[model samples]
Target: MINNMNKFIAIVGSNSNKSTNRELLKYMKHHFQSQAEIELVEIKGLPIFKKSADKFVPQEAKDIAKKIEASDGVIIATPEYDHSIPAILSSALAWLSYGIHPLLDKPVMITGASYGSLGSSRAQSQLRQILDSPELKARIMPSSEFLLGHSLQAFDDNGDLKDKVAAQQLDGLFKDFLQFVNIFNQLNNAKEINVQKAKDFSWDKD
Candidate 1:
């Protein structure tokens, strides 16, 4: 049995108050209470990222980075915006990566919700590539994705997933993420090298 101490951060990749992606993450936090401690984080109100010679990292971004650094894993719920992720989420990532590598080599689970049937498929795919980039280098849970289609109708009034099959799928994927966290932590062969490489990629270099 997995320990209850397995803490995770679930990032709501939207700025809107009425986001279905946020709703989906809330459901997971309640449903998986026995398995892990999932904290919901918001990307709202972060300023747009711009390259600076001073390598300024916002206090908000640094605070979020500290949370991520202390957590065992991360979960991101994204909504599709024109076949991609929202600009706010993209900017949030840029802030997280600039001179700060909290997500580097972190275990991550990708989930998405959409109003249409495709269920944010394109956004998730694009997110994968972004996470795989050198600055991010997140160890995303392989071969596992939870896509919620018609998400407006997916959950009931109590904020629980109404579809049994989709709920079961999320259960399995979350369990896999727990194991992925344990396994990733065991591989320390190149941990130091990876960290140095991420730090070296900073624009505030000589």
Candidate 2:
């Protein structure tokens, strides 16, 4: 049974104010309000990550991390830049993994939006690799790709998906994500070990 009170953190992977990625996440937040409580978080305005000897993490990053920690799962919406994830999103991930690993063993779902027909496929692929790293170790849902191509016209003025097929596809994937989260929660045998492993794997040493 899908938990009615499930909480999820949706990270806006773009820093641009005119981002369709944000629109997509917003749509999901409203579209699935009854299934889950989706909170959209921004990575904008976070300082570029710089390694500190003391392993300092910014307060903004910490706040986001806490939200992720408290949520049942995570959703990331990214826009392609140079055929990969944006620098701001990368910096946010660096800050997120610097000293605290909130994403360790957490369930993640990847989504992308793009102006081109190919969507942000390359960026989403790269993001999967990044989230699978030792520092993050997010259990990204397998084969759940929600790529919105020609995103400028993908949604209506009311912010709902215009295509019925695409809308149904997203609904299916979201239902799958809910099950994935539930199964992941039940299979927590390795969570402690994974967290310990992440903590022990130092960036300098690796």
Candidate 3:
């Protein structure tokens, strides 16, 4: 059985301001806090990504990578801009691609909200394509796709998620994500152990 006694989860939102996306993330955080150690990673402080700065990525980006690497799973809540994920989110993903690739073989889930009628469905769909690339090394959950419509009205002025149905759905998503992470961690640990054993059992060994 997989032991999730110390699993760490990271939550990221695209917008830098008081965004509904952040509220969704916070809601997930609250849901998982009792079951796992949670860390909130804000992408707002990250500088715009540039390929020329590869050798020395900004500290904010570097910090985000480390957190992703250390966590067992990642949850992203993105906001739709013009029917697509925000450029800031894309930039952050681009920056992450150059590093050690902490997302490889990890469990990830994406959700979003929009002020328009369609919610962030288009943006979430586009994000799934970007995340599906081989470089990400993550398993995307297919059971549910969360897209909040009229997001500005869904949440209160304090940025709290006021919709009970959305809150419950977010809770369910985190629970499933935790289960996925536990299984993934178990397999990863087993592989590490086998690799170590193989290294120690070389034919040249006594």
Distance from true position, residue 44, model 2, in Å? 0.6
In the range 1-206, model 2's lDDT, one tens digit per residue, is 34657999999999999899999999999999989999999999799999988988889999999999999999999999899999999999999998899999899999999999978999999999999999999999999999899999998889999989999999999999999999989988998889899888888873
RMSD of each: 2.0, 1.6, 7.5
lDDT accuracy of residue 127 in candidate 2: 100
Please provide TM-scores, in order, for all candidate models, with all chains considered together: 0.95, 0.97, 0.79
Off by over 4 Å in 2: 1-4
lDDT of 3: 0.71
Off by over 4 Å in 3: 1-9, 156-160, 187-206
**Candidate 1 clashes between residue pairs 3 or more apart in a chain or in different chains:** none
Per-residue lDDT over 1-206 for candidate 3, one digit per residue giving the tens place of the 0 to 100 score:
22555455555557557787777666666655677766678887778877563345787777888888777677788888888888888888866765446666667888887778777888888888877764454567776688788877886766567888877877787777767767766677544444344334322335
Candidate 1 residue-wise lDDT at 74: 96
Ordered from best to worst TM-score, the candidate numbers read 2, 1, 3
TM-score of 2: 0.97
- After superposing all C-alphas onto the true structure, candidate 2 shows an RMSD in angstroms of 1.6
